[model samples]
Target: MSEVEVVVAHRERATLRVGDVFLKIDADPGRTDIEVEAMTLAPVPTPEVLWHRPPVLALAALPGTALGRLGEPSTASPAAWAAAGAAVRTLHDAPLPPWPGQSLDEVAARVDAECEWLVSNGVLPTDLVTRNRQIAEAALRPWTPVFTHGDLQITHIFVDGDEVTGVLDWSEAGRGDAHFDLATLTLGHEERLGDLLAGYRADVDLDVIRGWWSLRSLVVVRWLVTHGFDPFAPGCEVDVLKSRL
Candidate 1:
């Protein structure tokens, strides 16, 4: 038997790899359905869906490594980063998934709640929380809904050289803000934003993208900590948040 490599094991979900197959075990089957459907609809490369039975969905591994991590530098070339950007544009241009993601109001409310949580728990300085909340407000404006990868972290993208091999974690695919994908991908890797944006080639509101950087960093700390991941680790989420100050 092959050793089961734990990809991620959180309160609501877990994923594991055994041999060449990755099994996603989710708490919600509906999300899994959405993932399978999104991959089918997306024009870009995606892993072959092997099978699904109840809680577990099997997927074949794709070529290459992740573009980068949140806190670490990406060794992928600028061309590769641009390729990622192009791939994102393709996905955004594809048909919308059946579901809908958070609206601007929903996002604002969540940020507000998380900010209060952080402040009340003394997790972050009140001024820091307050400042980021204001920054986050910029992203809370109306956006033309597109098919967005609700979570477009670099880790979800696999690349070989300058080309994208495949993208993973389609559970969050839905109609949402385009800048959200850009912001999510470039988080903590601000230096590469210019390269990515160059490949993206469409005019975007920079202020909102920056707003999401602050907004996303503020909201995710609690979840990461609760899941036994250290958001405060060097070159990690907390470090990214501190970089803004």
Candidate 2:
């Protein structure tokens, strides 16, 4: 019998892997629905949906290892990172999905609230939060919305050698800023940005990408803490924030 591996578990959702199949348990069925629809619409490679039963959605595992993880150096070749970037660009170029993404105002409000919490609670130094908040402002400007894989974390991307095998986690997919996806993929791995941009083959504002790095790191710290994750770990979120200095 294949052993069941707990991939990730939190109050909102849990994913389990048994043999080659992954089972996703989400508190909101709507998220799963969106994931399914997004995968179907995405032009890039995505996991094959084995089945869906309410809260439990089963998916066939992709063939390759993750592109990389946050706080860790990626062993993937530059070509592989570029391939991942190419895949992202393809997704962005695809037709927009039916659902909309969070508005700029909404994002700003969240950043403000999170910064306050980080400072008031002494989670992060006030100066650090303040500077990052200032930097985050750059990302708040108007942008052309594209189809985005809203949570384009490094671990969600898979690569085999120099080719992108597949991308995972589509629940958060929607129409959003293209730079947001770029920032998310390159977070904690700034050195790879150039390689990625080469594959992306589009002009982008570096400041906005940096701003997103700050904005995303700040907003996620609280959630990580509440969810029993350690953002303060070496080379993790805190380190990413400190790099902004």
Q: Where in model 1 is the C-alpha error above 4 Å?
A: none
* CA lDDT, candidate 2, residue 241: 92
TM-score of 2: 0.99
Q: Give candidate 1's total backbone clashes.
A: 1
Instruction: Please report how far candidate 1 places residue 189 from its true position, in Å.
Output: 0.3
Full-model lDDT, candidate 2: 0.95
Which stretches of model 2 miss by more than 4 angstroms? none
User: For model 2, how does the per-residue alpha-carbon lDDT over 1-245 read when each residue is reduced to its tens digit?
Assistant: 99999999999999999999999999999999999999999999999999999899999999999999998999999999889989999999999999999999999999999999999999999999999999999999989999999999999999988999999999999999999999999999999999999899999999999999999999999999999899999889999899878
Cα lDDT listed for each candidate: 0.90, 0.95
Per-model TM-score on C-alpha atoms = 0.97, 0.99
TM-score top scorer: 2
In Å, residue 159's CA in model 2 sits off its true spot by 0.6
Per-residue C-alpha lDDT of model 1 across residues 1-245, encoded as one tens digit per residue: 89999998988889999999999999999989999999999999999999999699999999999999877889999999999999999888887777888887888888888999999999988887887777888898899999998889989999999999999999988999999999999988989999898889899898999898889999998998888988888887677767767
